[model samples]
Each structure stands twice: as structure tokens, then as C-alpha cells.
Target chain A: MTSLPALPTPKKLGLVIDLDVCVGCHACVVNCKEWNTGGYGAALSDQDPYGADVSGAWLNRIHTFEVVPQGGEIVGEAGEARIVHFPKSCLHCEDAPCVTVCPTGASYKRADDGIVLVDEDMCIGCGLCAWACPYGAREMDLAAGVMKKCTLCIDRIYNETIAEIDRQPACVRTCPANARHFGDLADPSSAVSIMVAERGGMDLMPEQGTRPVNKYLPPRARKPLASSTPLPKEDTTGATGFFAWLDDMLDRI
Target chain B: MHPAPSIIIFTTLSGLGYGLAVVLGLGLLDPATLATKIAHVLAIAMIGAGLMSSTLHLGNPQRAWRALSQWRSSWLSREGVMSIVTFVPLLWSAWVCVIESRYLALPGLAGSVLSLATVFCTAMIYTSLKSVQAWHTPLTPACYLLFAAAGGLVVASLFAFAGGGNASLLAVLAAVALMAAWIAKTAWRRNMLTLVPISTPETATGLGAIGKVRLFERPHVMENYLTHEMGFKIARKHAAKLWGIAVVLGGAVPVVALLVLAIVGQVSSAIAAMFACVALLSHIIGMLTERWLFFAEARHAVMNYYNG
Candidate 1:
């Protein structure tokens, strides 16, 4: 059934991304593609590998933007323009349009974990599910002939054989900056939930009504340094002798 | 959004075919006539050909039948079911016209409603998509139904003229429908032009509190699937020229030809038939152009993130 099932105690297992430290390294994007391709659905296909058009079915991507600060006139040319690295993936929305719009019953949101997945066997590759997504999370695999998306590393997340510390999503586990967080957002007491509350994590495109489970913590407000210029030309070489002597006396004591 | 030829062909041909089915099912032209029988066959053939063309772009066309099982929530699935269901009555009506040489009211009326329903389902497939805000409107379905009706009337009148029947009334109706479809479509174009973008780069990235978000760099150096498929951009000036051409060819030429045929139809059957042919062909070419723009110009909300 394409209609979402009503589940009691459905755990919204999702990610909380911290934008402050994301550095736009694209490690998460690469790790996600590497893990998801070899694991769930079919291998994510690439159209061209070494050629000019090297497009592929990547599950995650990083987009860089220059913000002109709320009321600023200049765009990216301004000195104070803030740069943000946005890592995007499927948010595993509660009301996932991609799941409901599938002509085949291939796309479904898991009632047990709130993870959206595509059953490759039934996918017609009609590309309607990709179109329905407001976040551009889904991609049509050229070779596999199936829709590929972020499975939230379902195969790794629930695996028992792997060590507990390594059981998280490859993107989160492999993140060098600790930008990505994976936990049950449904539980208020979970670390991810508390972080979201404290840091004021927000949904990307909240107006779209996808009700995305994953939240993005906004970049910390940046302030200019108090003194960027040289202080009073500092009386040549070591002119403040009294303060220097006081520092030496304290060191001796 | 790629303006793919396969889809443009599918939507255009299916609309015209189903539109033809609409009038034929109502017994507009006599069922006993050879021309009417040919028209019936043409209608079914176009619908079949159109449905076939739609599967050309699918990666897993062999698994296309799986699409029929999920009509409960999917408009695309409903369209699949309706297209097949419509064939039953259409084939029956066509068989009766060819063999028995008469129109069956039960199947005829039922086929008409089903054909219209099929068009509605097809339109809803695009209209239901909230991701493409331009298409997420009642106007999508309204334009589809009007165009289908217009195309059907225009074709049905051609058969009416060929058969040497009372075609004047049919010609006038076809002309009016053609005019109305274009008028509604003009309004649709205006709506797209003056749209208040629901999602912007600022809102998409949740950076509105900070500043105007401008794309500094895309994730990939080359175009990815999202960029390739949804990044189709037509300049404003180019789009305006095409819109004017579409209106002139699809609306002005066909409507004028059809109106002229309504007057001189009975007096000069040969000349009227030529005029009807002009109306039919021009209307089709015009609709093809309009349908191409329908896909090309409409921006998807997901593109807000890409800012392409």
C-alpha cells in the first residue's frame, strides 16, 4: 500500500546537522554514496566516470552558499558575507510525498523506524518519485534501473555483527568534523533531541510541509573582532616597561 | 522539466486521442458511415500509441505492469488503471461501429466519461505534485480537459465534414473549444509569470535570518541527475516568442479555419474538408509546442536549493 500506515510508537530515527562546523569537506557525501551503493537497493550507477559529464546516483551532496547578511546589499562580494556548507540528503519525512506518489508500491516509509525506502524489485523507474520530492533527495540510477536515495544507512545502522560504536550511519561515523548526528529524534531525552532544542536546529524548507525528521542546526552568529587595527602604534620596541616588569615579578613569585 | 520529447508526445497524443474518444462516444458522427468507423479506429490507435510512447523513457519498462497496483494513493497508478479500463469500452464501441454498423448508447456514453476521466487522471499526476508549484493548481487539470475537448471536437468535426453530414454546428463548437482552451492556457502562462515563489534559496537553506543566500558552488563540477533533469531553463524572451507562436498557430489558425468551415461546409464539401484538415493539423502542432513549454518553463521547488 502506498498510503502511509499508522504506527504507534514510531521512532523517527533521523539526523541533526550542525552547520557551524560543517566545513564543506564533502566527506559525508562521499561516505554516504560509498556505503549506500554497496549496501541497500542496487549499486548507485554513474553515467560517466572519467569524462566531462561524470554524473552519478549519489545519496548525499554538499552545497555551498554565501549569505549577504539579512539587510546587506552586496551579495558574495561583501567582506562580511558568511559562507555555509549545506549537506543535503533525504530527511525521511513523516509525510513523504515520494513514497505516496510512487505508481508501484516500491517506495514506503517504515512504520517501525520512520525510514523511507524503495523496493528495487517493484520500481518502474518512472521517475515520478524523484519529481515529488521537494528536497531533490532521490536519483534515478542509470545502470541499475532503479530509484536510489539515502537509506540512512539502514543496513549498517541495524547490523548486530558490527561493533556498536561503528554501527551508526557511515556518513555520521565517518564525519571528520562531527557535523552529522544520528539518534531517535522522537525521544525528547535523546542526545540528538536535546542538541536540537539547545542549538535551535531547524528544518530545511519548513514551508514545503514535508515535516522532515532531520534538523539542521543554524550556524553560530558571527561577530567582528573588537580591535582589528594596531593599538596606538605601541611606543616603538617594548615601551610599556612597568607592565612588563610587573609580569616578570609575578612569574618570579 | 527536461521537456523530454517522449513525454511531450505522450501527453499530446493521449489528450488528442482521448479527446477524439469523447466526441465519438457521444455518437456525434453517424456510426454506420465508413468515415466514422475510421475515426473510431484512429481514436483507439492514438490512445494506444500514446500509452506506448510514455513507456519509452522508463528505465524498467518490462516492470511497467507493476504500476497498476497502487491506485489508492498514486494518480499515476490511477491513470494506468483508467487507461486500460477505458480501452474495454472504446474497443467495444469501435467493434460495433465496424461490424454491426450502429452506435451502442450504453458503451458509447460510458466510453466518453471514461476517456474524460483518463485525461483528468493524467492531469492530476502533474497537478498533485507540490514540488512543482507552477503545476500544483486547479488550472493544470482545467487546461488539460479544455485542450482534450478542443482537440476531440476539432477531429470529430473533420469526420463530420468528410462524411458530408450536418457539420456546421460541430465546426462552431470545435472552434469555440479551441478558443477557450487557448484563453485558459494564456491565464495559466500569466500565473506562472507572476508567481510568488514559495521557496527561495534563503528559505531552502534556512539562512533567511542571516542574509540573501546566493549559490557559491554546486556540489559537483558536472551536472548531476537533479541538475540535469530539473535545470532546464528557457529565457524569458524566448518563452514569450514561443507562446505567441503557439497562440497564433494553435488558436488563430485552427479557430479561423474551423469558423470558415462552419459557413461554407455544406456548399463546398471538398473545400470545407481541406479547411478542417488545416484546423486539425495546426491545432496539433500548436498543442505540441504548448505542452513542451508546460514542462520546460515550470520550475520545481527543489530547484530553489540548487538555484539553477
Candidate 2:
């Protein structure tokens, strides 16, 4: 009897980012650039480097924010303080508009698992898919003249030759803070699933409803402020003693 | 929002074709004159050119035929099918109007409805893309229909006035369409200005945390495809000037010019026809600017990555 073809293993690789622990150091960004550049996997290309200006292509980056307290109890006394760091990358959305809008079948989600990817050979430089996307996750590789984005490191994660421990994506592997988790989300018992369950993870721009597969766990709340004595307001009155007396004498004179 | 020149010509030029064809089919004028036949032919040609121009936007032109199969969901497909349907009746009616003028009047009337339907379908194509909040409203399609009729009416009036076919009626119709066009323009502007982009940075990241998040630094400094495509923006002042131009040239000028000519009653038909052409051009310019701005003003959720 003819040997039956081995049943295809269903593997869905995804990333779970922990906002509470993400120090926004961008170590993951650096590591991603390094791994993606040299690997047989998705290669990220960069333009000008070490000339008048230096810029390298990176699959991910962190953003910092300072929201001015607007009519809230958390309002700081004028000039007190603020800052929030946000890391940006593709959510690998399930209902990816980028994929559907592609004229060629170049951009497609794997049916066995929901990882959205761009087939480099098929994609033309046409940027229709980029326009269709609300999340702005897809980026075009200028050198190749085709669309590019975070692949979740498809090559590294699936290589049978590599050790199981080394199979995770470069970004996830290099996260010094352990802020990023990589795993099969379909398995409820997975660490990423437990983290998502314990902390309520949400989809970005749920109103647009692209149904992004990646989950971002909200930052944990800080402890309540301890009571502290308020500082007195500054007196606009002039300096004491000689200046004060001189001003008084001048007024009298 | 990239104003592909081909698409701009397609939409604007085609608007004139379908608009004029409608009036010819309506039997508003005497069948004896050859002007109706000429007008309908020109309109049909413009429609064909517009359809042809749209294909240039597709990456693989060979797959363009598959676009017709997507009418179940895609508005672009609906527009394609309807535009083709618009010609079937138009060609039939035009041939009959020339060869059997009196007998063909009924066929022309049937063609008029199809022309109007084609215009509505074209409008729906833009109105359906929910991501484009500016074009998502019901007013977009309504505006398209009105403008198409307005353009057609103006052309028909020209032919009628030249032939002495009740110049007063032509002027009055032009005036009414101009006024309706103005109202529609205002409504479209109101909807675009008032609607807010529903996407937020927090929501985009899928982080439900209640804290402000901003782009401190991008993943890369060099321009990426997402940045280049989504970062399309126009200044507020330029938008104001364009809106002003659209309102004045597209809206006010036509109404005032047509009204004055109608009331004067001296060479009223010719003046109304002139105003119709002028109004159509003005409306097209205004609509083009508005459409461009609509794309430029849209804030893609991805730009949140760059903190744009």
C-alpha cells in the first residue's frame, strides 16, 4: 500500500505584548532589525546609513506620549509631569483590509492558521492595500518595490533544524523585559492565553473592527497617591529688607 | 486619495456624457433637430472614455474583467455593470431617435431612466467606501445624480434655446438644478467637516488602557510605504480656499447667472446653455478639489504608528 501523506501540522504563531512590563527600551526593535536583515526569513531593508544622517529599517518601534491632564482627578499641578511610551507593529489582523484590497492574490492569510503575509513574487508596487488598511500596519519595501511588514518571523519560528527553545521570533527572543510573548494563541493552556485571560487584552480600533489577532494587555494601574502637604503659592511681593525698605522710602519721598 | 488623473477625467467627463444623454431621452425637445442625436453621441463617448480611464487605475489590466463579478459587495463593480447597462438603452434610443424620430420617443424616455440610474451607481461607488468618511454619506450619491441631471439639463437647454424650443422653460430648469446643486454641495461639505475619524492610537494598538499614547519615535526614519501612502495631508488654510472656490464657482455663480438670464428672457436659452457648460466645469473642478481634500484630510489609523 502507498504511504499516506503526513497530515499537515497546523501552527498559528502570534505575539502578545504586555504594556505593563514594556519598558519601551526598543531592544526588541534593535534585535528585530538585526535578525530580519541577515536571516533567510523576512528581510527588512534600510536606505541611507552613517552619512549626514543614519537611519535603518526596523520592523517595530516604540513611541512615547505625554497626555496633558484634561479635566481629570489625575491632573498634575501646573508644570508637574507626563509621558507614555507605545510600541508600534502589525497586529496581523484576522479581517485584514490590506489582504482583501490587493489586486493580485499576493497578500493572503494562511487558511490553516490566521497569519497574514505578502507573497513577494506576486506583489506589484501598487499601494492599494496600504490605503485600504486603517491600522497602517503594512509597509512597502522600497528596494524591492513590493509591500513589506512584520511576518512574526515565519522562517525562524518554523525551522525543524533549529532547537525548539530557539524557534521563537527574534523580537520576542530579545525582549529583555519579557514584555513580549510568542505562542499558538489557539491553545487556551498556552502562557500567552493565560496572560490574556488574567489581564483583559483588547483589539486596537475595535470600532473599525478589523479584528486584529494580536492582543495588547493594558498597563496595570499605579498605587493611589499618598497624602502630602501642598506647597504654598509664590508671593509676587518684592525681596525683603533693603529692597523692601528702599521701595517704601521711595514711595514716601 | 491619490487623485489618479485618469480617474479624475473619468468621473468629471463622464458626468457630462450621462447628464446630457438623460435630457435627450426625456423628450424635452423637438425630434426634428439633429442636435439631440449629436448630444447623445457625445455623452455616450464621454461615458465610454470615463470607463476606459478607470481601467488605468488597476495594476493588472487583464484581470479588469473580474471586477464585474464583485457587485455583490463592491461598489466599483456595481458602477462598472451599471455604466455598461446605461449604454444599451442609450445606443438603441439614439439609433431610433435618428432613424425613426417620432416612433423612437418612447425608447428615449426609457433610456433617460437608465442614464439617471448609471449616475446614481457611480455616486454609490464613492459613498460606499466606509473608510473614506468624507465620501461615506448618502449625500455623495445624491450629489452625483443631481449634478449629472444638472449637466444634462444645461446641455439640453442649449440645444432648445438655439432652436427656439421654449427658452424660458430651459432657463427655469437650469436655475432649479443649479439651486439643488448648491444645496447638495453644502450638505456634502457639512458632512465632511463634521465627521471625526473614529480610530485612536490606543484602540489601534488593541490596548484598552486609559492613558494617553503618542509616537515618541517611529520604527524607522526613512519613508515607508505606509507613511508615504497614509501620510498624505493638506493644510487647513488650503482646504478653506478650495471649499470657498467650490461654493462660489460651482454653487453661486451658476445659480445667479442662470437666474439673471432666465428673468431677462432675451437670448435666455443660449445664456442658460452657456451657464450650464460653465456650471458643469465649475462643479467638476470643485468636486475634484473636494474629493482630493477628502483623501488628504483622512487620518489613517496606521499614521498613529508615526504619530502623524
Model 2 per-residue lDDT tens digits across residues B144-170? 888777766666666665662565676
The backbone clash count of each candidate, in order, is: 1, 8
Which pairs of residues clash in candidate 2, taking residues 3 or more apart in a chain or in different chains? A63-B216, A64-B216, A135-B302, A203-B206, A204-B203, A204-B206, A205-B203, B19-B152
DockQ of 2: 0.19
Worst 10 residues of 2 chain A by lDDT: A1-10
DockQ score for model 1: 0.76
Docking class of 2: incorrect
| Residue B66 lDDT, candidate 2, scale 0-100 | 52
Clashing pairs in 1: A70-B210
TM-score of each model, paired residue for residue: 0.95, 0.75
Lowest lDDT block of 10, candidate 1 chain B: B263-272
lDDT of each: 0.89, 0.67
Give chain A TM for each model in order.
Answer: 0.89, 0.77
Model 1: residues with Cα > 4 Å off, grouped in runs:
A73-78, A225-253
